[model samples]
Target chain A: MVTETDIEKLALLARVALSEQEKEKLRTDVEAILEYVSDIRKVSGGEERAVPSLVNVMREDGTPHEGGVHTETLLSLAPKREGQYVRVKKIL
Target chain B: MSINLSELTIATARRHLANGDFTAVELAQSYLAEIEKKNKNLNAYREVFDDVLEQAKGADKKLPNFRTSKLPNLCGIPIALKDVIMLAGKRAGACSKILEGYVSPYDATAVSKLKVAGAIFLGRTNMDEFAMGSSTENYAYGVTKNPFDESRVAGGSSGGSAAAVAGNMSLAALGSDTGGSVRQPASLCGVVGLKPTYGSVSRFGLMAMSSSLDVIGPFTKTVEDAELLFDAIKGKDPMDSTSVEVSSSKLQVKSLRIGIPTMIRETEGIDPDVRKNFEDCLKQFRDAGHTVKEIELPTMHYALPVYYVIMPAEVSTNLARFDGVKYGLHVSGKNLLEDYVQTRGTGFGMEARRRILLGTYVLSSGYYDAYYAQAVRVRAKIEQELRDVFAGVDCIATPTSPTPAFKIGEKADDPLQMYLADIFTVVANIAGIPAISIPSGTAMREGKQLPLGLQLMAAHGREDVLFEAGKEFEKLRDNRGGV
Candidate 1:
């Protein structure tokens, strides 16, 4: 029941480009998987948001480690870094 | 004198190091030599730590004081990481093209614990790219072939960790399981794997695949070795809010009640030899004075469907961090949106992209109620059912995987068939309970004897129940006199 437009929109939302061939193949594969997992729709409602084990785990905002301990190391992992910051394509 | 890895467990390794029978450097070298001999074809390791011998030398310095002083269980033991678990200053790519050469800035909590216990890092093993697929075929580098038969896949996404242990490249290893990533690979590779209770082990440095289901586990030659590694790495951490203080209850009783879900008989594509092996193993327990009975879990059939909905939703969210700018592969385009689109498109493998798109669709505005929300409610229902079942039985049992190691390219083309491989093991992850896979017996496939695994699941925080049952099963299996 899913349309090609749905597939293209999903790809856009997910921010993944697809070749025409890849789009066709992915559309087919996702259709089959969706059909299989659609069985989840069969079971009715329990309390919504009633995840039995989930608890709100909040902690005070504080420095768990000394500042600057990993600043350099983390920046160093950037695919494209200029001095202290990660470089990205210009939007404007 | 040669090192007999088959005879060495963590317990014996500690004794040998304390007595100076062989230095830690020597043990590390033996494993490195084995990796060098086998890795070319098996592709078990993505990268072996260059400083392994140096780490072993540090362990050697601590050996002299160990005779009189109490030493940690994992000291001087060489272990492998499943690449998804970060080791500070080493490359961990999760076998994905996107993060291929990205180095970890800090150690995973589990890795830090192993370091404190003085375990030597042998290497980072290969895995499914972003831990997406059941077969190692999704790896960007290459597939990790089964150590038993090179033509077959070493089950994944922790395939390399399992293969390294089974192939004798390391004594013990760590892998993260979100479904059957640890136990399924262990089943295929003929080793022991343990998936501890969700939140019992911190996921601080293990890359997120499915946040609700992800747990760090151990792959080892024996169940005892698995327990040794589990003990060292399991604890609450300040960095991870979801991490829990693991207090394994002392299992006081010997005669245990084990439940075999009757729905397994209806599991599609289950090999006959696997079924026979499972029945035979159940008979062993029955003969040994433990009660084995069939239990009906009506909701069991829904586990896989639920997993697909939840896992992809989490995957799309977690991997959103890997755009062009931050970590690894960057593809330039006219502007920002195109940059992200092209980078992710080229960076991810086919399976990753499929899951990502599927996840996006399910969580999309119109479809959210039908797929994602309903799946969460059903997940809670499934957990409640399991909790009720655990009231009567100490553990639930099943074949770790429905079949023996499949051919390398056998199920690669069809993603759904590949997901079926995880049918038996995913329930444990779904319920956030502890599960273990132990080598049961071998099945003949194409005239080769491929090993199978028997899985045991216990209630949450009851890994002790699994370990006790696992050890007993191992003893019974060894004493079967080759029936």
Candidate 2:
């Protein structure tokens, strides 16, 4: 069962805010969903998850495009921007 | 002469365009008129492009060069795009308020290829927020109603795309499928939908819902039209390392074996009419001199459970980018932490946030090993089981959906009941195989005929087998004459 505290922590980890009402509603919904999917616990496949060789899989001969070719279009989408860089609140 | 839009196919459209039966501009006007008439009630398209006539006029110029082989098959055809797909300079928000009004910076690989093939974009269609839900009710926009019955839901996350084709608003449409997003809606709308083999079509432009299982598919009026759209959009791209080349195939399959999975008999929630229609379809196949056998995939039932775990885990990871920084809706809070939370809380719909929370929970420290890790193991087992089953049969057949289109808002409040709609369709995604949903027949619902679909799944890189089987079944369905 998912507790209120658990849903709160999940909200924090996922960077989503929730009200008391949404939290209570989400708690029950998550609990029911987990119960429905509880059968996944019975799986005993002994092997670890497969990891493909994505590293070094890129082609070498393809020509790289010029840098900042789309800087105007890319920066235009930002909510807040100054010059070329996107402005965000200070971390510290 | 007024063109009968419902009688049109990509093949017929191409032939007519070549023979000068009608100009591309006239064709575009026809579809635009249809959308203007039907879309208000059906809620099919999110935005019908303003440049449709211009695009068709350009194709008209190319028609003079047809004998040079420069003319493409789709050169004047009108197509709808799911809102999740990126077309450069066009808005694609995945039907979520978070990315509302966010214009795409570049064309998705498929959209770029479609432009090259001479297809005109009709516009973006509606979908579930972030392609998360089984029905389009979760969209920030209004729910997409069934074209046949306004009281019923057009099955989703690609509901808008399916409805567009089914209602004849567009000749064909492109949709992204993660766990039956394309096939389910196609089934409910009584149109043909194809989820090609994983990696067969490039996903460079589609919004990520579950990267592992995500694939872009087509919704069309006929299986042949589905093949045509798939052909235009498929190929490897340097931008997407996971994309692979799907060769051109003109396969003529003869007397192939089709498997009816043993789980079908045991699974619950299947409507009685759905089962009866499936049996009638099997009987037709048997009388046509094809082998019909019941095969077992021991881990078949585990597919839905594993999907719920793995999908959210990937979703939480993929959706983390929408932190009000680079693009989309931004809400300022006291600090950076509050900024992220507030923006996501208000921006995401209930279904999107719910999946995000479920995904975050499974990947959390204590529960990761139990839920996410275990799901990966079971997923692998399911893949192996499907491989074993496919070695014996060329294709696996089942009802595309357990039931036909349900009334709008019927399952809106219950997430679990909505999730059950994808139970049969998720197996193809889990195994990374090709699957197609063809309209099998219809069932009487509230005195209206609601269409049902027969889903055929083939082994990996075996879309040719599916296309052949689907076309053959279409012949039989035409003779029977119901849907």
Candidate 3:
């Protein structure tokens, strides 16, 4: 039931360029994979009993502490940093 | 007898350390030498701490009390840590170019606990970038090869840790399990990998990946070794809100009900040998006086879809901090968004980008409710099913993987195929249950020997069951002693 367009969209979303041959290979392979997942769908009902382990994990209110991150560590991850914060390209 | 010192479990190591059989300095140096020799081919480590000898030397002086059995269980053992864990003033990049050259100012809580336990910090093992892939192939450093066969993957995002243990480069290593990142690779590499119940181990120091599912565990050579490592590092931490202080029942294995999933046998692509070995294990359990029963967990089928949606959604949120303006590899551009995209596009490897994109899409405004929200509901259903199953069963058993280790690049070309590597292992994560992989038998790959593992999963907070069952199985396997 999967189409080339569907695969193409997925690829674009995933940012992997696929050639004609690659797409062809994926058509069969992905279909099989999807079929496997679809079988999983059967094992877990579509929506009836679907529930997650993490539920409303709320925390008590507390006074905010100053972020303990070393400025050097924070700035180090940035391509560029200003005095107090990371510098980014001007969007406006 | 000298070599025996290195092979000793943490428990035995502590005993010897107390008796002055060896100093911590000697233990650290021996492991360092072994790692240097074996790691050249395995590519298991990203960085070996230069201060290990100094740390060991200090420990040697304080060994008096530790030798007296009054100290923590890990006083003299050398435990390797995965690179994703924060270590004070040490590089802790989760094996990604984005976080290259980054060092943490503070130690991860687990690392701090292990340090306080008098454990030696060996080094950081490699991992999939941001803990994304099934094989260490996704690591920017390079793929970690299986210890048994260099041509095959060690199974990942904890591949490096598993390899370090299997290759005997470290006595024990810490690994994180989001979706079998620890257990699957442990299975493939023929080592013991434990994924503790969610909140059993604090995650204050681990790099975030699907926070709902992530838990820190160990990769070791034996079940007792795993328990030794787990005992030292597991406890509730004030920093990690999710962690709880639930002490497990120290019950022995003789009085337990082992459950095997009847529905899992119906899963497609399971290798016949793995299936047979799992059955053999069940039979052994029966012979050992443990009752084994078949149970139904119908909600398990939706695990993959729920995983795809929820994991991606969480990944998208967790990875948002790696913008170009932050502390990793970044590219600059005229516009902020352009800079962000280019930095991520360039810094992240293919697998990371793939997962990030999938996450972004699933959590995108338009698709959030339909895909991500629905997946959360599905996850709850899966959890509910687990509660139902656990009410009747003490632990569940399955083959860790559909098959044993595959060739290095066999499934690397296809992401979906690679994702399936964690399929059997993922259910444990989704339900926040504890699981462990132990060596069962050997599988032949292109005429080379490969080890297959049988995984046992237990209800939340019941790691004791896994250790009990694993110990019995180990005894049985030792008795059999065959190819």
Report per-prediction Cα RMSD to one decimal: 1.4, 1.5, 3.3
- By DockQ thresholds, what CAPRI class is model 2? medium
Off by over 4 Å in 1: A45-52
The positional error of residue B43 in candidate 2, measured at the CA in angstroms, is 0.8
Q: Which candidate ranks first by DockQ, i.e. highest? A: 1
lDDT of 3 by residue, A1-92 (tens): 65788666765544344557756766665565444444433333445534333454567898556665566655655566677776766667
lDDT digits (tens) for residues B1-483 of candidate 2: 567899999989988888889999999999999999989988999899889999999999987676368544688889999999999998889998999669999999999998888889999999999888777885469999988788999999999999999999999999999999999999999999999988889999999999989999999999889888888888888788788887666556589799998999999899999999999999989989999999988888999998999998899999999999899999999999989999999899888889999999899888898898888888888888888888899999999999999999999989999999999999899888899999999998988888899999998888888889999899987888857
Stronger candidate by DockQ (2 vs 3): 2
Please count the clashing residue pairs in each candidate, in the order shown: 0, 0, 17
Return the lDDT, model 1, position B208: 93
Cα lDDT listed for each candidate: 0.90, 0.90, 0.79
| Interface RMSD over true interface Cα atoms for each candidate | 1.4, 1.5, 4.3
Misplaced by over 4 Å in model 3 are: A1-69, A72-78
**TM-scores for candidates 1 onward, in order:** 0.98, 0.98, 0.90
Predicted chain B of candidate 3, TM-score versus the true chain B: 0.97
**Range of the 10 consecutive residues with the lowest summed lDDT in candidate 3 chain B:** B1-10
Model 2: lDDT of residue B97: 93
